[model samples]
Target: MHTPYFSDRPAAARSAAYRTLWRWHFYAALFVMPFLTVLAVTGTLYCFQPQIDPLLYPGRLLVAPATTPRLSEDDLLARAEAAVPPGSRPAAAAVGSDPERSAEFVFRYPDGRQHSVYLNPYTGEMLGTLSVEQRFMQRVRMIHRKLLLGKPGELLMELAACWTLVMVGTGIALWWPRGALTWRGTLWPRLDWRGRAFWKSVHAVMGIWLAAGAVAFILTGLPWSGSWGEQFKSLATRANLGSPPGVWGGSTRQSTIPGRQLARPANHAQHGDAVAGGRGMDGMPPMVMDDLPLPSTPWAVGATTVPGSGPAGGSAAALPLDRILDIVRANGIPRGYDVAFPSTPSGVYTVSYFPPDPKREHVLHIDQYSGEVLEEIGYDDYGAVSRLVSYGTSLHMGRYFGLANQLVCALISLGLAGMAITGFVMWWKRRPQKALGAPARLPTPVTMRRWKIGLAALGMVFPLMGGTMLLVWALDSLALKRRAMR
Candidate 1:
């Protein structure tokens, strides 16, 4: 049943707007179809990210049985560093999350060499080393995020996201019930005839589910990409990651750390011991304010050293990695707490913050007990909207399970693929009804008989798309008007 509003209107008037939006939806579909297919196929292949993350780092997620005294963080770091040699400083030091687990580390070595080393953190024992970069999950993520083209690839993906967002809105409008929501009509199709309604049911049901996820992911992903990068950045600033209007661009304090900053996290790469004194755990002095660094740059470098956040001072006091590790242990985080070691004394111990996902993994800063986050330029102060936005991002990217999350996202990519297919087929079937062939369609008329002019008006709101639509409308409309005038 169609909505009563449209039904009440005379056929001529009703069809004008109904058909106009429909045609615009059709055109939008045509523009996005091919890319949707690419996304589908690539996304389907990406579902196995979980299976691949471990192949890159072995004996870590699950440790092999060993019967030696557990190594101290210092010793394990020392061994990992020595293993790397001086020219190639280790970037991160990761131990197993479990106390009884394996001592493994993803060492982002200099020259861009990354190796997942299996060690006896106690004995500095070298069990094995694998490449984190070459993992299947990594490859899958590459395609999903950018389809392998890096910068250009990301741009294309963002444009696709914007188009996808538009499609979702248009699709919802198109699917709106003619009247009151119905059981058989709104949800499942009537079981009477098992024909077009069955597939329509499938598409509609799926579309409804897709609407929420699609909108969420598209909006969240928009900020991370280049097309809407500036706009997205603005959103982040509003969300408190940046300064107020008229304020200068965010400085070190105003910025959020871009990636993980584990101080002694088990999964960290080797030579990541900014907190582990020069000596191994046995002889190292208790870490003090001077011993640990302050907050610093959030980006991860092949060997790039992040600048410090300066000296620490305030209401919170008592700086100690051992205490943080103890608390993690006390909280059942276990003997080997995966802590984000302070890059700066101001920097607190951050736990499990892999990028693209700010939540999912637990993050705690061993503040001067200033009792606030030390890693983020702006920490713990996120408002409710900000927190919700952060959670949405994690769920969208499937980062809750690390590699497994990657795989789930890869699978979601397939759903997008299906949407693209169904969406395209629907579009291909409708292109012949009406074509906007002239420039007059760029800016809609105040009183328009057909919805096409309204669509033309909407197109003008987006600078680039509006310009393109105006050009197409002019050319196509001119030819039509000429033919009609003739």
Candidate 2:
């Protein structure tokens, strides 16, 4: 009963399990480190966009305070249109409440690019023109989302995000104290430790502190991913947890033209007004609601159909910009909102009010000819899931609580970057010369039924990650077999 084999079985199993988990943790860190660092840096830069933009383009975005009443919306629009190149169409105008800020008018160039023409609201003088892609923060956002490589880049980022979850999970397990915890090596790093030991302690302590924030950042960001975001949106909408029934009201009319055809290229830039060119249909432009006019919309009503304008009764001409402004004020849609002009005779004027607070977000579709508010969706009408997402989006962008929110998000981002650097240093110091220096594979792999089941469950939740895992497993099995033969 007390044989040596029986006595050592539990210890051997524990050792095998630890090695296997350590190997997996190493692999996950290797894959996600570079991506996580890039995301962290870019995300930090974007979080401070409010402060950075003014310093970057003062002449274009800033203006001297004026005692005189600002020029009317129509006058500003006219000046903006006159300042643009020939063949440019005025798409939207953003009215800001700030007394010292310039007005912004978005225009669609003949070549399909969207540009913003800035004007001094007080004098109706052209401040400057900047393309959507030209803005520094927008560029950082694109890189953060897509790595500037388009679809492939987006997929890579998604894959990295998925693996980051795994990395964090395994990192926690590795950092977990086995024996009684001590302050020096558990909650805080032992600064007196030498070489790899010191670096490892730093990495472990930082990771433990960052664990909650890292998870939150990753989950909040998933809603914006190309693949997972779309699927989740479709699922939430179907469950009535997105837009909810009848939010579109009695209007069942769909745009004959697809939103994509009317929308700018997939890479459309969002600036002061954050106007996305049109609702897109494939590659063609269509007059749809989602991603039309405003580049960003509340997640819940993103796919809600835009109501079309009826035929004009007396005058076929659309309502004047001043009239729309009057309606906006009358409806109490805060002072700073973007007005998207109807692209076609049947198109409706779209007013989107996206403030820093999610509760005040609003979108109104007004009949271009009759000036009737065809459909209005506000934060109060959003489904539970949509409301949650709206709040999360605000937090992710560091806009929820102003400066405090920005500082918290910045710290998290920079913390992640620091963890990556520390991890790399730890690996480099101990890595064997002239080798990949990965953790050695177990000589006799232990049967880890529970671990396998947990990993399988995770893979199911993220299909892309699951598929990659299968491929890696197959390749590893082949390598093991070859090594055994040798």
Candidate 3:
């Protein structure tokens, strides 16, 4: 018959197993503590992604459709330029999958500069912009992610990731069964603080209590790998609960640019245009016919991905924005859809649907040349991998639970920060004199004796101690240059 096992007393002289585990746990604990500190802070701040985004962006991120008719992309671009300071340009627009969140215009300014007033996508109204730096949570996240140290800070954090795994391994080992008849020393926290046994037990027991969920959270934080994590993402996607990746949008769909061409270049640009000469070998006329107002030497407009939106079988006809937008709307496409006007004869007018839930993206490529619908695919249309990727994106950002989820992750980070502080205090009280890793100071005899076994018991469990061991070894062998010079 099977029974639940918990113990402190080593079984029948099998203290060896307990000893091995004890060593492993100590090694893992040392590095993991600091890593968890960073993870906790960053994770907590990231939890509020949804709330913070709306607050930071205000009416721009979410705004109901205009009472007036939606302005054309050209009109919106003109408005954005007129509204922002000179030399400013539109970076990208948000295509609302939700009508209530509809605002197509998004303008990004020069790097390092802040925008206080943003134009509304749906109505071309000037929506207010606020400073993200002023928010408390935002400031906290900045510290957690970068230690307020910028690039160097991020590098330090990346180096800390490996230590977290080590902690998990050693923690499990230390938490393993110690004895058959006794367990009070393992499961519950001991209040007998005067006893060394009590506090050690508290740290171990509390760690184990949170281990399962804590481990899961750690695994969840990493999107690229962890057991059958991909399968779970797949399941989420099959249910149509897909999220996009952080820092990258789900797809590379183009939004409507003004199609305003700058002046032709000084040299071969005009020659090339002269050769194409208002008509191509195919049917369409020159994209820039009159070559108005001495076009600025072919500066790049927002790049249109050519040959990307061409019809699956053949090219579609060239059409006006009015016709293309009308076809898109009539096809049951929402106002939030990305409308890409064709740049070349072969290029088609394309529309991509990327919802807050990326799974809702409905991609359609229409032949702009012919105004013919080329291809249409919805959330159900994606392959297994695509769907999995979307959901994983959302879960990584805690979009799965919305505000409640973000809040929980944020709190966990704060708890981790607290753990770091307490852990450092505990460490401080026990710091050895004559340097941390030096051999224990002998009494008058300078004896080789001094309780080596007990000291080994403590040091072997902490890998940070192992690192200290290496450092000592370096000095002992004169491998350290300072030692060598001496």
Error of 1 at 474 (Å): 5.9
TM-score for candidate 1? 0.63
Total backbone clashes of candidate 1, pairs 3 or more residues apart or in separate chains = 38
Any runs in candidate 3 off by more than 4 Å, and if so which? 1-29, 54-74, 85-87, 97-104, 108-117, 120-123, 128-159, 180-202, 224-390, 434-486
Residue 278 miss distance in model 3 (angstroms): 31
Q: TM-scores across all candidates?
A: 0.63, 0.90, 0.54
Estimate candidate 3's alpha-carbon lDDT, on a 0 to 1 scale. Answer: 0.46
lDDT of 3 by residue, 62-128 (tens): 7766566666755665765677767543333344445455344333344523333455656677665
lDDT of each: 0.50, 0.78, 0.46
Please write out the lDDT profile of model 1 over residues 376-434, one tens digit for every residue.
32223444444555665565556555776665666566666776666545434433547
2 versus 3: better lDDT goes to: 2
- TM-score of model 3 relative to the true fold? 0.54
Which model scores highest in TM-score?
A: 2
Worst 10 residues of 2 by lDDT: 265-274
